[model samples]
Target: MKYEQLANDILTHIGGRENVASLTHCITRLRFQLKDDSIVDKDKVKNIDGVVSCVNKGGQFQVVIGTHVEDVYHAVCKVGKIEADSSGEPSGEKKGLISAFFDTIAGIFVPIIGALAGAGMLKAILSLATTFNWVSPESQTYTILFMVSDIAFYYMPFFLAVSAAKKFKTNTFLALIFAGMLVHPTLIGLKDAGDAVALLGIPMRMATYTSSVIPIILIVYFQSYIERFAKKITPQAVKTFLVPIITILIVAPVGLLALGPIGAFVGEYVAAFFNLLNEKASWVVPTLVGALNPLLVMTGMHYSVGAAQAVQRATVGYATIYSPGALASNMSQAAAVFAVSIKSKKKDITALASSCAATAICGITEPALYGVTLKLKRPLYATMLAGGIAGFYAGIMGVKAYSAGTSTIFTLPIYIGQDNSFIHACITAGIAIVLGFVFSYLFHKDEEAAPVEEEVPAGKTNVELNRNQSEVYAPIKGEVVALENVKDDAFSTMAMGKGIAIEPTEGIVYAPFDGKVEVLFKTKHAIGLRSNEGVELLIHIGIDTVKLEGKHFEALVSVHDTIKQGQELIRFNISEIKQAGYDCITPIIITNTGDYLDVIESDKSNVGLDNTILTAIK
Candidate 1:
């Protein structure tokens, strides 16, 4: 795989697998929380073939991987053997409680945000459909869709339980059970009752827990402590049943009586305080939120506000301050990207700006904020200034969202029909977009990414520049398959350019086209070939087999050696490779793919040595 070497190099420079505490990825970067960030070789990582750059932000060792990060993320994780959420518990270089708190909350919520966004979209679409009467309110479609969308929110505790348990390093099953007890049907019936329900003669306070946030978090956090304590006292002979029995017996009622009410109380008071500020000084909330939004996102403290938003929605239907300012900030960021796209003359810079603009409009601002605005500096100033102005306008208009979801264009329907606020919200959003564009265009000077003097820019694995057809002979006799269907995303996504992978029947690797050997890996598992037509090619022997250090392979030629089509390049012992437990599906790739218009793989299921397996279109 093209990314195999890159992954190995990245893992090595990031202090190896042992130094990594946890690994996660956003759209453009691989966010690694390391056991020690001091050991990272940042310059070395930046210079790696596929890596874009590195940043130390929000206590994360962020290695920018561009659009093909998914491929590299999986490759790194696969080689590193990191499972989902398999981070070590918080202990290392000491961080304050505040940093740890925000980090934990963001970590738990970020993974489930996609599901949350999808549910929000469903709700928004349902509202729009019913508003216009396109779908009958009494119909099964509406009923089913409504329930599907509402289930996530109605049982927020259950979802939070699973995530919080993971963060707390406790039992997920027991956490789910704890959340279940709070929202149990029997408990709901006694919500209005003046008397407390007796659980084994202990008077337990009755509280409604559906859609509750803080209660379950508190329960799970304390559950970790209680479960450990119970296990310590219980004997190994009866530990399985008795430990859970005693832990639940203690935590269940105590949670319902003490932790449950206390957590919910905190949520209520927080909402009350915000509502209080909203009435007294309306502009303060929006202006501050808008100005600090990009900063909040950068540090992952935005999710703290997200938690508060959820709390406000559950306690009071609709949220006013957060949604309005968040929308303004997001749209303003989009407008800044649009401004940058319009001002830049370079195709690559313009293309990057255009893509970031799309994501920004969809209510995801990280791409625009990090990839474009913050990097350029002036666009960021424009965004912050324009965002505050727009936020002031939206806040004054008293715009609020009735449904609980991010303020994406898709979820705008939720803002409609709330005290005839649709027109106001729409107009306010338009102003934000226009003003953002104007301000950014004025403040930001035209700028472009650094120009490249090479045929294909360095750090780009491949580029597709032209499509003049050229035959690529088969390098090995094997079963031919489409490149897009390859198991590795790097090859399939054309991130490593384009070509096809083969399930080889033989171990010999032949020269596919007449060229000089540009470079050969020290491990003898891969080689780079540059054809006379300037088509750069890579032939990787197998997935992650480079760690073998040339054990089962032999190279027939060295770097700069003149090679002809059908000439033998390398020979491997297939049986020995398989005995070492590695898949030997070889991948042939065009590394300068971006310079070509397209690299087309053969349609045939099978091919012989030196037969045409691909056609590179210039």
Candidate 2:
């Protein structure tokens, strides 16, 4: 299937392999850890032939490639030689508050989605078995399968440790060692003893870590920093030996004695607080989550609530308000997708919107957000209003789920209880769906079709170029060179949308066309311009010239300032620049080449000033 080609294409679209710091693929997306996030051309990646979409979610830049992600992942690994799960020190600055929050929830919950799905399916099968008397609940066969199905949920901390360690860039093996200490058989035995055991002159107070969530994750994050510090300080001669010895020595005591207990205490307090809130103002919690959920989802902050769910489950064995609100919010999105599919005039948009709606109902919301709700802004508003109404009802009724899974119509049985509260919850979900459907349908407006192109009059004269009219002139007259020959791909690929490159004949650069200066980088190494004829150009002065501190160069224009053709944009002392050990090869290319049909480069071996260099055509 030419998998290598696809990988190469994807790498090119993302600004090449050098731009990537790390890469991993999950069930359906290729996640990239980029060296410079700003260099990532998301629109270019999205428009790539094989890509379904591009997303930045949960602190990871993701490219959705559907089910073939494994093939692409293999291809990427072949070229980069970096395994998807290898642990290393983090490369960039610490993530922001919201980015960190979402990363934590996504890191914790996404790994569990498969487990929850498989467990839910098994429970469904078990229900069928018991209902039809195929196997009694007491049967040995039933017991075995139940244990298999239940282990993933019952011992969730072990699974969380492995995934969280990867996310935190810590040693997974050490993290497992830490998780084992928390939930060791001996510790469980100690708990059974009721304060009977002591080790190393300190009394041991053991609590079951199985089925718990937050404590181990937080501990692992802290452990990553400690491990990284140890690695940094240890001398090269015996660093490997010294690192493990120091890391274990430092982490073991702190995790076992301090962080673990503090985390547990915090979890208990939060659980108690949530219980209090539920008892005092249950409706308020759900109402707020519901009302604000649409906004959160739009801004990609809804993962915060998922973290709250994990904490709730670890402390209280059930999540009271958040998931129910999320369920309604998701249904509202599905409704908006459906409305767009029905009302939109464009056939392609209708198909995309309908498919996105179906996908959203099944528990994935990206397609719905990227393809529908956000596309038609009014539908998003309608969904938020409807979700709030549904959340209010669910909260008043005290609806809760004992288990976590996808919040969809088919999983409604999970919310059912023998009490009237269950019935009320069901009615609330139904009304929420209906309200969303009504509001979206009423508010949605059909998009107008694009006008068809008309032919120009035969007598009309237009300036024509044989092959060079649209080609970017040498902004700085120099010997032309291919971008790939340069040291840095980021600088090399500045001409990505516009094709070709040139080694400057001289260091002084002139404005190629009469245009307004859009951006003059602070470092004086690059300039962006929009021509009066509507061409967008990026003239990067030199390879890695940003390191030169603007020496030997003087800028003549500021950003947003207008300049005429042949205007002196920047003056450079060519020999002085070369003596400073800097390459003066400059790349001049069109930044908005996508709007043109073709860009043809001139065939001339040596072109003079004002000579036709390249041409763009419709």
Candidate 3:
């Protein structure tokens, strides 16, 4: 509801799209990497119609929109024209080395993770059927299901090639050609060769590319550079044939000789690193993952582990390190939401809690995360703490899944038909739910308490004439015009109630015969007041000054303060507002226009804070 206004308000409060380098969202928040952080008004953003909260951390501007974050994110993207990461590509402008590295990982992994999840779930089902003796291992049905589930992983290089091509902006077919070489039969057969194979008289090492991760990515990255250079050197007439030719010629040998081996080694090292952690400090894996899974899910970097863990499972018999923590984390989140559902009496909160609980139980945690547990803030703490405990238990019990898939009730079959690990998995989930519910139910009731209302002191204009007629003075010195002429649709269309607009000659706003300051935005770019004669007004300083984030403004008064005509309401600097590229056309409107029968406007061409801008008539 009111998504357009929410989008507009969000865009404005975050310093406009020009200030944004790029944008992304987790389950609940719009993560914006802004060009200038100092220009954002965090408080004003939190007060926007749809926003739940605002946070500035790790060089990102976060706007929490709860469950509908995706909708708002798309709306913001549409308004901003950001080439976002449904492609899972890092769409931000230049970032520091570390940020870029993480961004790249998220981009490359996000697009493929869904496919990975689907295949993993399929494998889990196949495992279940075979375990139950419903399908024989040698049967055609089992073979086909196995093929569908394993093919993606067996040929992960090809899929990664497509995604990496989009990220690096290279010729996709060229990248595929490069991936083809890595998994070619000759290369596979070369693994059994007694000696190194020669390519163009250069010695090349033999390695398995099936179920591989990094090698193709490296080759494709190099291929993109070669393709880019080839298009530049070759004639446009012969570009089509020449580009692929040059790319293959350059990428093939170097990939075989250097990058492929390096990437393969890197993948091995990554897997070995986790294995080392598992052996030396088994509990650390579960503890760290359980504590940070929610955060990892938000940045979308959790999928990065799939590649490394795939290598682990292929090299070893099963994936042990990552799955335990995932199961615990999911169960704990579900339990937390369920606890909160019954604790609250509010229908909306209860409905959200119930739905999210069901979602988490099925292994999809986004709903529980954004709509219920995290929304309340306290339940998240319970989930995290409980998850850590459950994960530690899973580690101690050596819980393992034959294959890595999402942690949900549906995935329980993956843990079954293995050694006693299935029993341990059940125990871990049970502990997670029990601990999560108890702690959350115990500590989360404070947020459900009824809010106390605050009374506004007298002195706000209530002296209604026979027609409830009142004179509203101008808030700023500027040219006066009808509200419909204002640039913003919310004001121009009178959706925010009828008002007059001004193209101010000065930056300071004076109280327009103010009886009380009903509202004043912390950003100081806007103010609301009730004049001594019962005229209510909403004075917005600029067309989108909300974007300037109070950079050029300062509040001179606070809410509920009584004031006289010509009293200074705010002080602002137009230079920064102008530099930031916002129109400083302010709107002064009657918020309760329906209360009066006729609202008459002034015929004056230009006026200051002393001029009567509108006459509210009843």
For each candidate, give its TM-score against the true structure.
0.60, 0.64, 0.65
* lDDT of candidate 1 over 52-164, digit per residue (tens): 67778556787877646768988888888886442322122234998888777776776666776677668778878888989998999899999999888889899999999
lDDT of 2 by residue, 1-618 (tens): 478777877888777878888886543457787877787888888778777677774456778664456688888778766665434222222458877778677866776668866775575467556756899999999999989877776777788889888888888988888888787887787788787555566665566677777768877888899889998998889886888778778887777666777777777777788888889888887777766776676555665576667667667766765677877777877876788788877898789988998998886877787566766677887778888888888888888765566666666545543345446656766877788888888998876757545343465433333222354565766555555566544334432455456666666677777778876655567778887677778777765564455667778787765677778888877787788877777766676777788777666555555654556765
Rank all candidate structures by their TM-score, best first, as comma-separated numbers: 3, 2, 1
Say which prediction, candidate 1 or candidate 2, comes out ahead on TM-score: 2
**Count of steric clashes across candidates, in order:** 17, 14, 2
> Which ten residues in a row are the worst by lDDT in model 2?
85-94
In model 1, the runs with Cα more than 4 Å from the true position are: 1-92, 138-140, 447-618
Highest lDDT among the candidates is held by which one?
Answer: 1
The local lDDT score (0 to 100) that residue 37 gets in candidate 3 is 89
Q: lDDT of each prediction vs. the true structure?
A: 0.79, 0.71, 0.78
Report the backbone clash tally of model 2: 14
Name the weakest run of 10 consecutive residues (lDDT summed) in model 3.
86-95
Candidate 2 wrong stretches, greater than 4 Å = 1-90, 124-136, 196-198, 229-242, 417-422, 449-618
Error of 2 at 520 (Å): 18
